[model samples]
Target: MTLRSKPYHWLYAFVLIALSAFSVQSVAETSMEQTGELQLWHKISLIFDGPETSERADYNPFIHYRLNIIFTHPATGDRFVIPGYFAADGNAANTGAESGNKWVAHFSPNHTGLWKWQASFRKNRFVAVSAKVDAGVSGGFMDGQQGQFTVSESNKELPDFRAAGRLQYVNEPYLKFAQSQTYFIKAGPDAPENFLAYQDFDGTFHNDGHKDDLVKTWEPHLTDWKKGDPTWQNGKGKAIIGALNYLNSKGLNAVSFLTMNIMGDDQNVFPYVDYNTYDRMDVSKLAQWEIVFEHAQSLGLFLHFKTQEAENQGLLDGGGTGLQRKLYYRELMARFGHHLALNWNLGEENGEWFKNHPTMPQHTNERIAMARYFYENDPYHHHLVIHNGIDYDDLFSADSHYTGASVQTHKADFSSVHTAVKRLRDWPVINGRPWAIAVDEPGDAQHSLVPDRMNPAHNNARQNGLWGALMAGGWGTEWYFGYANEHSDLTAQDYRSRDLFWDQARHSIAFFDALDVPFQRAKSHDELLSSAADYVLAVPGEFYIVYLKDASHQPTLNFKNFSGDFEINWFNPREGGEMQQGSKTTIQAKWVHKAKLNNTFNLGLPPSTPNQDWVVVVKRK
Candidate 1:
């Protein structure tokens, strides 16, 4: 599909203004760098002049001024309907301006070639309804303007998001990068839920000790901050950028954060003008956040954007369908939708968990509406999933916008990770589409993946916590800091607290990627294996991957109706090592027409490392 020019094309005159790294044009005013140095997947902003505004409190500029830049990549004929936002001022990051005429359309080209674009700016009058109603003929200066630009090859270093091109959801169980066409496997921190509660951010959490205790300086990561990296208003975000640097240095690829946690734990982070306000967004604060997120993207980190924490489920626009909720969703998609890799989690532990709270709880239909709204409005339609309290079954529907499940468990010892992932992975396939399931939060309610000083071995964690999820065909696992530990989930300042556990997680991700295992094609089947401690993920006779918790005994693989010659390789799970070569094996099925013995063979293979955990890989030869 291509983004064709709007009607009345002859009325507006197009002028090719000289730029450094971008090409921009409009009827009245345009702002963009020259396209000579643009790279694939690098966010480039095309600024345009709009109506001047003083207050966005009563009427949200996000919903009222709907500016869309329809971009068409010439080489591939791929079209992207990118949203535009009202940037209070062109330099909102430097100067804290809440209202102005600076409007912008951010674009990150998936392909390296010339791309054409046109803007469709409209004014909607209603703030109560979700649909758009025309506000007469007169509009902003840059409405219906068109132009084109070019994108060069990415010179971005490895482990950087700019190097990955666009991260797209291709109706599969995982997200894939447009450049390499490789599926992503996430492994990182899911805690420090208040990751955005930075000291420099323009907000205060000084209401109570619970909120104030979680305020972060990010001091440990200060050394990782580079000279030319994104820093706002002198040195506002060195520490937060440094935190992402620390995560990338540790080989972690994803991080989760609550953008708003009003009336909840760490009630510090919100996009509103202030803690009490909800109509308008804090432009300067959001701009600073963009700096942090942009740096994270450059580091190749997957942003798991947890939009709302539990307590604020009904706080916005009458529990989802009202104008407040619509405005919030539209603003998020407008500002950050151009990001290469991210997921908009509807709400953390969403649904009616709080009965005695002041606000009305969110109903099932409201949650569905929220997801459906994002599915319809967001042009990118990046992975849209909802976090759960306990009951997530109602949210699963082929018609809904939930592309995956971000599960949270209360089970102690995390023994439930395997079954939970298995069921979630299998149930979606039973539905119309497959879901990319991840155990975002797992383990006990207390002491989950604490410092190495407390739990160094991490036997339960390695065996049940990490391996169980992977063995069940789970996409990835992120460590959730428990409440009972020091620097717990909300108050974690240093990421090194769970350093050893990260090593184990990275080893698992490396094992699959290095082997080039067709994990997406594999299915988890516990019925094929005899031992309860053993888990099998196989693609029939093509490939079989087995994970043994107790490697002392061998597990039987019943090749009932299959005949194939296979090569076996074993990998140590606890201690990361190369795939050890094993013997070639054959499984013969029963034969009748050929006059052969009518019998099947059940192969029992010995463990590579006895009494220790191991992963056995069998490939058809």
Candidate 2:
């Protein structure tokens, strides 16, 4: 038995490690020196203040930030060459009223070590330039006194984490893919502010004090809690976190919490926030909310909520005038403060309309607002994502910064792995951020309500997340009780999706964690793959995964390079076990893509007969 056979439990161990040596230049090869300026251009243009998620009293206000600059050399610490603040003058004068902050900066960092700057700013008229700006470009802080970030968004009253007179941005830069103790989001030039973080701007908190277990905030109304009517148990926040922590202990990184997920919108003639009614929202259940967050925090799991990424506009259903919807979004952002969870997906699969016209005025307006809301508010909370079809590029701006997008590529059933992975990688490189995929495996084959498809999608999604640019976390497949009749008896098996989800995620978590660190950082070597198509590779450093679906017709494996000694192990995702390793010397000259959505791998033409269903894991010298 191989280590991949038995599933491992995550205990949720985490340690905060500041980045000491990062080759930012090594990534993307897109040099900022070419794009950004260093002369003290116009600096007085925008303001970055308040808690992250702030909404204007009526209209969300635009922050005017101006940076006056000057830079000295590194080694000699010599004469001033580059003028400061990117010379913040002579830029565009007019910004659309509906649009927000228009600002820029003149800053330069020469090396990969800690870089610090003393930045001070003045807000609109009222306050003098009194804000502190001991900002550091590297992982360190303005100085030794302020490198760490303290969050108090959950509480009504601020905790005494900082000194009384200390006023700082409650922003945690989500400048990386993986979630950690503080912050979410990987910094890029996608969203305005060109970043994603959490906040309500003026430091808003709805919970009176805070439940001891608030893992992360959710709209207290998400669960089905009536007015003191306890039918379904309140979601045990702590238990959920504890369960997740256990998963993390075993190697799981994080979870995609269905915080505001509601029932089907497919059936509704007019869309509504599908789950329990809003009037039935119970504030007392807020206690339960804390417990959930506490558990998540304990287990080193970061929360990626499902909804409230934008306003619950009831049902736009075409009746929503563009102005009406956009206006509602602006206001909703002000109210919800454009925040919640790591990935604030606006909605689930609403169908062709949502996907087709992604940047339609209403959608773009809402999307832009949401992006800014999170960026201007809470960036770490802005690991933005949108769940739906394959063409993720269309879902987001060719340059818009959305929550990291993902696809529900139901493996075997809906699509193939290779196809799904292609879409995931290309989405961000050509567009913004990156996309994620899920291995959509079906446990209840006989009882599948929708189209009973499965594999290349599932396996590919997992591989892409583990090895692709869009850092895939665990599986995001559907899980729940199948549709039922009036007199249905609920059994544990009834929720086959749940069981399958837990099982698949548990196993796949092991597979993903086994591969690489900074998985998203791996460059695309798709060019060095099989030209014929039946097989594709998700290659990391010293490791490569060849997803073969040659079940129907025998495939001829032709590759560019497969030299020297290597160990090949097959992993049977179907049987939930591992296969023995095999030695390979003769490289087949013909292997074309053959697997379909149902994952029919027909590998029985010449060399060997079929054994167990397994994914080949290779360790090459």
lDDT of each: 0.76, 0.30
**Residue 602 of model 2: what lDDT?**
25
Which tens-of-lDDT digit does each residue in 1-621 have in candidate 2?
Answer: 554553541211111121322222222231122122121111111112111211122222222221222333344453221111111111211110212222222222222233233323223321111123432122111111111111221111111111111111121112332212222221110101000111110111222222212223222222322233211133322222333334444433344433332222111111111132321112213223333443343343444444421223323423233433333322222222212223455544423443334222235444445455444433123345565532344555554556444444333233343355455655433343344433222222222222113321344323332222222222233322222321011111112222233344455445443443233333334444332433334444344444443322433332333333344555444433444444343222222355222212222322233432234544444
List runs of model 2 lying over 4 Å from the truth. Answer: 1-284, 300-302, 308-341, 350-362, 389-399, 409-412, 416-418, 428-501, 516-535, 540-542, 548-556, 561-565, 572-580, 583-610
TM-score of every prediction relative to native: 0.88, 0.45
- C-alpha lDDT of candidate 2 relative to the true structure: 0.30
Cα error, candidate 1, residue 385 (Å): 0.8
TM-score of 2: 0.45
Clashes of 2: 101
Per-residue alpha-carbon lDDT of model 1 for 1-621, expressed as tens digits?
222374644433232123311222335455433322477787778887777774364566765667778889877889888777778876788787878888887877877789999877776564323344344332446666778878888898778877777777777777788888787888899998989988787644544344676678988878878889888888888878888988888778898998888887888888877777777777878888888887888787899999887778888876866778877887788778888889999978887775675466777888889988888878778888887774777777665778888887766688899998888887745255688888888887687777777888788888887888888878888888898988798878888778887888878877887865677778787777778777888887777788877656666665545666666777877777687754425544443455555343333443455677878887777
After best superposition, candidate 1 residue 101: deviation in angstroms?
2.6
Q: Model 1: residues >4 Å from true position, as ranges?
A: 1-26, 29-37, 54-60, 74-77, 127-130, 133-137, 204-210, 354-358, 428-431, 582-609
